[model samples]
Target: MSNNSNTLLGVLAGTAVGATLGILFAPDKGINTRRKLVDEAVATKESLADSALDLRNTVAATVATNKETLDTKIENLVSDASYKADDVINQLEGKLKELKAKNKKLQKS
Candidate 1:
């Protein structure tokens, strides 16, 4: 989750707690207070849902970016290894030619 998500959740939690406490202490009629509590609960639920969506988006974006970077790195490593293998094959071929030439010269002498 992102920093903004964390902050938003923290703020929402604080607001919900504060509102509940204030309503409990107030000297309002019981029916009105109950209605206000229901309204506050609905609003808090919506806010939490929105925050969860934001968090999910952030995680998905992060995973996509990391996967791309890892793929690029793996491709580069394979390319480098292929070049090195070709160089080794070339060196071995050169050595084999030298040995064959030396053998022919010795046979003629």
Candidate 2:
């Protein structure tokens, strides 16, 4: 599972265990104790839900930032490759023209 899910699960498990322990050891009447447990459980659930949402948003933002960075790197690599290729082609064209002129001079002599 994702980190967010695991974290939320841990939070929920901890809340349940703590609430159970508190209820078991409390001196209050059973009805009041039960009500308190229920209220605390609801609040914990809400808190966990909020935390999960925030984690998801953070993950999404991170992913978007990474993707943009990757795209820019790829673009730069492609542009550099194109420039190198053009330079090589121009050099080859110049060499070919020089060879043709030398061949013509030899034939004339």
Candidate 3:
């Protein structure tokens, strides 16, 4: 799990523990205390669900952004390579033409 997940779990766990301790020590009726604990548990569950959703969204966004960046970088690299290859082909063609011309001149002489 990520740090955000761990931190959320810790916070939720701490809230439950603290609430339970408070309920146990308070001079409230048993039924009231139980109801309060149940309510607190439900709220904590909802909070955790919300946090999990938020974290998932954040991770998905980060992955999408990274993928876009990688794609652009790959496109640029391929374009650069294609240009370099074309340049090399042009130079080789020029050198071949020069060699052919020299060969023809030597044959005539």
Candidate 4:
């Protein structure tokens, strides 16, 4: 994702630079050259804005996906812990019953 964004930004920058250089080198009246520059600037600004929006959306989606995955893992871990707790409780109860039986036998004797 980082690589893709970098590539996209690089492409946009290259395009803007190429357009500006081309316009500057072209033979034309002063007024025409200035007008071309303004046009190029506006186009570049719009392109950059659009690229930024796209990058923002991509980042937001990735964050949402990661959050969901983290939530699922947490839930699964809690569920597993609950089951283990139940097993431990059952084992303790069994041990307590055995001790009680031994106590009763000693009292009877």
Candidate 5:
């Protein structure tokens, strides 16, 4: 299976094993055991939330880095295109001037 599927299955299996172990090992009365389980669940929820936030931050950083790299590439392409355009315009202007001068000489002859 895919990596994501494997990771999800692993998490589910780990959670089930952990919950079973916690319930089996408790020495308190039923009510206290239930309360303890609730507390553990809450703590696990918080830990998962923290992990989700960390993942979000990492994704944001990666996106920012990719955007900067794309912007740099676009800027370089624009600069190169502008330089090429200028060279073409200069060459065309020089050719036009030469043509005009040749025409004038031909007319005079």
Candidate 6:
């Protein structure tokens, strides 16, 4: 179902095919052929382990990059909202001052 399983299955099938062919065609004794098969299996396993590790590292790096980008976007959004809020507050303060001045002038007159 998973990608890893599929890849492993493919690797195993190829190894089996190769081993069968080797046994059929080899001039060496049965014991030597078996030893070679075992060695090949071990090498394949090690290679798969290395590949899995590399995949994990790549996934981790991608996650970290995406998280950093999201954090930066959020920070920018907050900063923009704060700036707009301050602008609105400044405009309102100015209007209030003008209204108060007009009221004082009217009262004195």
Instruction: Show the colliding residue pairs in model 1.
Output: none
User: By TM-score, is 3 or 4 better?
Assistant: 4
Count the clashes in each prediction. 0, 0, 0, 0, 0, 0
lDDT of 6 by residue, 1-109 (tens): 2587578768766876787687769899889888887887787778778767777787889899999999999999999999999999999999999999999999999
Give the lDDT ranking, best first: 4, 1, 3, 2, 6, 5
Cα lDDT tens digits, model 5, 1-109, are: 2465458557855885698577869687988877877877787777667656666787789899999999999999999999999999999999999999999999999
What is the C-alpha lDDT profile of model 2 across 1-109, one tens digit per residue? Answer: 3765787788788978898788879999989988988888888878878877878898899899999999999999999999999999999999999999999999999
The positional error of residue 25 in candidate 6, measured at the CA in angstroms, is 5.9
Stronger candidate by TM-score (1 vs 3): 1
The residue pairs found clashing in candidate 5 are none
Model 1 scores a C-alpha lDDT of 0.94
Best by TM-score: 4
lDDT of each residue in 1-109, candidate 3, tens digit only: 4876888889889988998899889999999999998998899889888988888899999999999999999999999999999999999999999999999999999
Candidate that beats the other on TM-score, 2 or 6, i.e. the better one: 2
Worst 10 residues of 1 by lDDT: 1-10
What are the clashing pairs of model 4? none
TM-score of model 2 (CA atoms): 0.79
Worst 10 residues of 6 by lDDT: 1-10
Off by over 4 Å in 2: 1-16
Best by lDDT: 4
Work out the TM-score per prediction: 0.86, 0.79, 0.85, 0.93, 0.76, 0.66
**Which residue pairs collide, candidate 6?**
none
Model 1 over residues 1-109: C-alpha lDDT tens digits?
A: 5578778988999999999999989999999999999999999999899889878888899999999999999999999999999999999999999999999999999
For model 5, what is the alpha-carbon lDDT of residue 37?
Answer: 78
Q: Give candidate 6 regions above 4 Å deviation.
A: 1-28, 101-109
**For every candidate structure, what is the RMSD over all alpha carbons to the true structure, in angstroms?**
1.8, 2.9, 2.0, 1.1, 3.6, 4.1
**Model 5 poorest ten-residue lDDT run:** 1-10
